[model samples]
Target: MSTARDVPETTGITEPPRATGLTEPPRSAGVTEPPDTPGDPAPAGGVATAGDRARPGDAVRWRRLSRRMLVIHPIQEVVRSAPALIGLLFAGSSQGGHGHIWSLVGLAVMLVVGTLRWFTTTYRVTPQYVQVRKGLIRRRVLTVPRDRIRTVDVTSHVMHRLLGLARVEVGTGRSDKKDGGALKLDALYAPEVDRLREELLHRRPAAATAPSPRRDAAAEPTTPRPTDQPDPLPVPGNEPGTEIELAALRPAWIRYGPFTMSGLVTAGVLAGFVSRIASEGNVDLLRIAPVRQVVDRVGHEALWLQVAGAVAALAVFVAVASTFGYVLAFWRFRLTRTSGGTLHVTRGLITTRATTLEERRLRGIEVSEPLLLRASGGARLIAVATGLRVGHGAQRGGSMLLPPAPREEAVTVATRVLGTSGPVTAELVPHGRAALRRRFTRALAVCGAVTAVLLGLWRWAGLPAWTWQAALLVTVAALPVAADRYRSLGHTIVAGHLVTRWGTLVRRRVALDREGIIGWNIRRSFFQRRAGLATLTATTAAGRQGYSVWDVDLGEALHIADRAIPGLLAPFLLRAGQPSDGMDPDPGTDPIVTSPGA
Candidate 1:
């Protein structure tokens, strides 16, 4: 019954008392277990179920995180509580040094709280679930089923690397929700982290079904990874099969960074900070000596020249900021695959991230081409997978497949990742003339309204005639944009994926696995109803939760839905000469069903 091998610490394990329901296990000095209530409901943090307690037959050996955390935690606490500490310092300064004593007291409190985490937080990988018990005042147990595990992200920041530790985040189907992150181990020994990640992702279910929790303090899970299985990550030597080199960072790609417009995010943050400081100090930015000098010089320039100069200055600033940000974020970015049926992403110059995505969980990918990036022949790639969110501007979170690079490199990487160029490069079927009309009418209508408002202002509000003149220029500008939007509109079924493309400024082309779709939604607007066009939404339990195919011919939309997930809308569709479920059609009200399952 002794399962501990090369794990001297777990060798001294004693099984938990069944009568108490996971109350506490034997621990070393300075380690304390949180009190467990037998009949309480599970806390907000997810544990499989309170009822799934350890059985008498199972051995639950609780273990602590890396002792180095005793140092890391306090530093993290100080950083998180910086504002509060600063406020206290100010108050103490105003209170004639009484704040010094309070500051000392605050430091003591942080030390106690930070130290307690090393004692109170204990995790265990049981046969059925991976669990972490934390919190001193409000003891909570969080867990996720090993069977449903979707991803295992092992990250090591600069501090973590220096400390020889790494954080392990376990992602499951349910763990992808907003309330996820319940199953994370802040920092563990680097060796143990790798072992746990390997075991969790590469072991067979039958191999680890029996819970034998006797393991050393720094030991990995006892479950051995199947030799036949591929390594989740392509380590230097233990690669199971020939590693397929997908894409790697090219030094020249840095030139494309500025075109990504990622600098706008930095500009926004700086602008907000400047505005806050200006407001607080009651200072006028325009009144500043340097600003005034520039203003005076510009005031003498022609309007067009002034505008051009301003634009040029802004562009230069953005380019510099964006290029710097890009270098820091994707310094050594790489994407690769293996015969192991996994896609790996590793990047970051300072805070390194190594992510492994099971090819099985990968539904598809999205190719994003922002206006500036597109104009510069650059693009980025994001994963569209279960339990992974689509990252917003500048920050890809953990879903980035490729950083902003040449569009050709992006497409090449995407094609190899998905195992086919048909989904990545295939020409999509165009939506009919109705969609073209819909796209243009909406754009023109908005432009017309703005122009009319400006014309009225010029006529009655004593505004200069230039107001209407500018509106006319805008109306002229709208035509090309409207055409670009129409050109971006396309959809088709490629291989087993439902390919969709739409958008203008930040264009996204997504190729989603049809098998992942759970339901179909058909939405037709008042104008769309008249124009005989409908937007079909493909609902899935994955990225974005829902992907919409906007502005498609109503009949073709239905056909696409049927083709995507055959018979999903069969029950809700109208039969020739027959009403649908006693609901009349064409009653001047558009028919829309949100996720009508067949």
Candidate 2:
């Protein structure tokens, strides 16, 4: 048994085997046999030998992951230096020669710290699993069991491509919030990463020693099939390639352009703008300029020229920022799939990031069709998962799988990857009377504030405003209530999902699976009692972008309340002792009785 005490000191700490001058012989295409056993050890030479001889349930064979290493984007070197670089540039431009003195100290500290970090970071793989342990002060040790491993993503940024390195992210399901549970190993040799992935995926399943099915002599086939002909098919789960086709590739369009390009650009532009802003002395050209110098250079007669020059400079800054943004966003976008059921995503202009999500962690699917994308017949798909934030932040992360795909292709991918069919159908409950009233009142408050601000501005400018801010506010305030009365929508649970749709101009349709909901709150006010409406807010553990489904009929609220707790609590109680059936009995036509936390 591999116990904690037996864990070798070099387990995840020692450097990996150095790459040998090696190459694999080419093979002609055909169906290939998987390793016979899952625990088959790796060969002494680089090529992994898929296990074919071991019995099922045997101890996992351990083998060092020794293959060519790859590094992530080299630009990460510059990106990591952003803080010190900005400090240096600021010091150089601001304090004449004095700032340069401090800049040297800053640069020295950064170089020492960064170099130490580079040498200390390390990762390793064996037949059983992949392990990563790094961090100078708060050391982190992450071990992902091979079976639990879902996706292995390898990414190469421009720098990585140049240096033949890649960043590898191995995603297990539901990472712990505090620890950043997902496994990350950066700047590894590319070939080594690929070999590790192959080891994870290809090492043969430990062959089961279980007795084979017996056949009567009379029942056996009279003769074997012709040598070139196919053999008799094995039963379900008996054979590997019997039914599985290499999971079809996500369509080409989805893998390229759109989401990939957009994500890269967005991250790039952000990184560039942040780098520039941080580099300068936090100056905003729009608000502050070298006014005295500008006036002196062009002379007092051309006053407009000074203002124009300022505007041009701002424009130039924005233009340069956007270009850098585009370069970063579209740089080296890639999406690939492994033989195992996992999707890999990698791309970055500066600091590279890779993400892998197992098919099982996927709870719900969201397909977004922005106007521009819709017109171009392109759509983006996002998977709502539990625990992990979508990605870097709420805005970009929730998407485990993103490939700009056409509408039909997008829907197809959703079905194949998430087991969802077509678009999720959700009931649209229009904002109820109280809810509408609240929206209208909120709108009115906003309008009132705007009207007051405009009136003050009008006085200050000494100009008569042509628009009636008061009237505009009132009309806007009244629209929600009217929209509710006329076009109000409400929803009901359909096939274990809560469908919510509410909005007039910017319509939104959100569908959340029942299992995806982890928590909820239902509230009603005095005014709501008279209107016969209540608010129900449902919460999901879906990554960091927690979802909320709110404001529906009081009857629906009650039904949700009735179902939520019993359903959630039943499984645990069953594990202890079977509970009575009434715990979550279906509520037939009549509204369910109100309950809290079930």
Candidate 3:
């Protein structure tokens, strides 16, 4: 069976997995139930833990965060408030120039609040669960069961690097919609981060929850065991698996970075920053000498020439910004498999990051290609694993298997990771004519709205005739977008995976494992119902917790779900000539299977 990092170490150390790091000396020392002394900070209750050192009274130990946070937090707040501070400084004599006074008070308040978190936050690792306690006034305590852990992410920003500090986030296999996806420990002594990560994942499942009074005579002698306990327990993460290098960033791949669209975001941020500064300073951008010169030169040029110049400038800006962001985030990116049965990703320039994902937690992966990236013949890979952050944030997308790169390279990496060529490259079954017509209808409605708005402005608002003409011409592009979106809709079931591909601006093909699907949702909008189509959404406890195949024939949607999980939907479906019992075919069997490790 494929298992998560079965090795007891987070770094993939090949130690013979152990049930208890609890040495024989401790047990033999006549310390039954881990003696509680003066410093014992708990009631005599907690779930039994499998793999950990038997340090006297702490079935778990409370650990404090590093003191270095007191410095780091205040510095971060100061930097964050710099823009606001500058604006206040320029609030000027017209308002009696007293804004600086308010800014000072604000900065002091921020510093205190930021620094207070360090003193308030406390966390600990125990046999049963990982718990974090924080919030000075509210007294919030977040607890997550250890067995559900799926990913460990460690990151160090520029300031953190200088101080030998790192932040760690432990993901508890919670869906993004759920509260408390991770328990974060900010500003830990860098080396402690490693030790903590290893300890947390080192857990092995206990042999048995209830040891029977009647022992198996034959099995007792035959299964000679260590730990000498009645149960020769099977731990969750202690299954055997080998590690291998999967993929790594190549220098040539950097050429595609500009097409990743990260640049466009950076451009927007830069523009916002510039606008904020100008507005705060009460300065007119057009009054600047360079700005005036550029405007005059462009105004005097032919209309086509002016348009071409503006496009060229914007392209240059985006390219530079994109390249810079790419290098900053992925300079030395490397993806490798560690013996612990985890996929380890390490990358970054100024702020380094290391993310470890248990292989068993991976439900599937997403191969995405935005419009520009597709045009540039590139694609990216995102791992769809439980507890693997799913958004664009740096802290979240630790699941990024590959940045934008050649489509062929992406396909190869995906094939290797998923371990099947069939699902990775199989041709998808397309949504038929009704779905196609629906796409066109939506597209035409959008174009019609835009054309109407432009015509109103040209006639009633006295705008130039060219305005409506340009809008009408631009609306025609929506037709191609509609076609592309329809063409993108397709899905197929192959090799234990349900592959669904869709989207126009960003085409995404997701290959999700059938075993991970917990349930199936059938959705039909009013328009969809009229068209005799439905959307099949596979609900899993992993990735986004849901992946949907849109605009599919109703019967086919049922077929896809049934094929994905043989008996899952059988209870709900109206089988041939059979009356509905409103329950599963097998009444005694549990609908939810707990053994797959999902």
Local distance difference test scores for all models:
0.71, 0.48, 0.71
Per-residue lDDT over 315-360 for candidate 2, one digit per residue giving the tens place of the 0 to 100 score: 5555455445434543454444433444545555674555555544
Ranking by TM-score: 1, 3, 2
Best by TM-score: 1
* lDDT per residue (tens digit) for residues 403-489 in model 3: 888999899989978878777699999999989999998888877788898899888999898878887887798899999999999
Error of 1 at 83 (Å): 1.9
Of models 1 and 2, which has the larger lDDT? 1
- RMSD to true structure for each model, in Å: 8.9, 11.0, 10.4
Tens-digit lDDT string for candidate 1 (1-598): 1111122222313233335443423332111122222221232111222323434113444667888888888887777776677667768978788786777678778877888987888777655556676788866666566666777777888889898888888776642435544368988887777667655665424333553322222232343334334345455532333346688899999998888777878888998999987996578999999999999999999999999998998889899999988887888887767445667677878777777777789888899899988998888988887766554442544778999889889899998888788887999888888888887788889888888998998899988998888888988898889889889988999888998998889888999998888888878778988887789899887777788888987777877887888865665566463321322343334476345589
Residue 566 C-alpha lDDT in model 1:
80
Which consecutive 10 residues in model 1 have the weakest lDDT in total? 1-10
TM-score of each prediction: 0.79, 0.58, 0.77
Residue 314, model 1, lDDT: 85
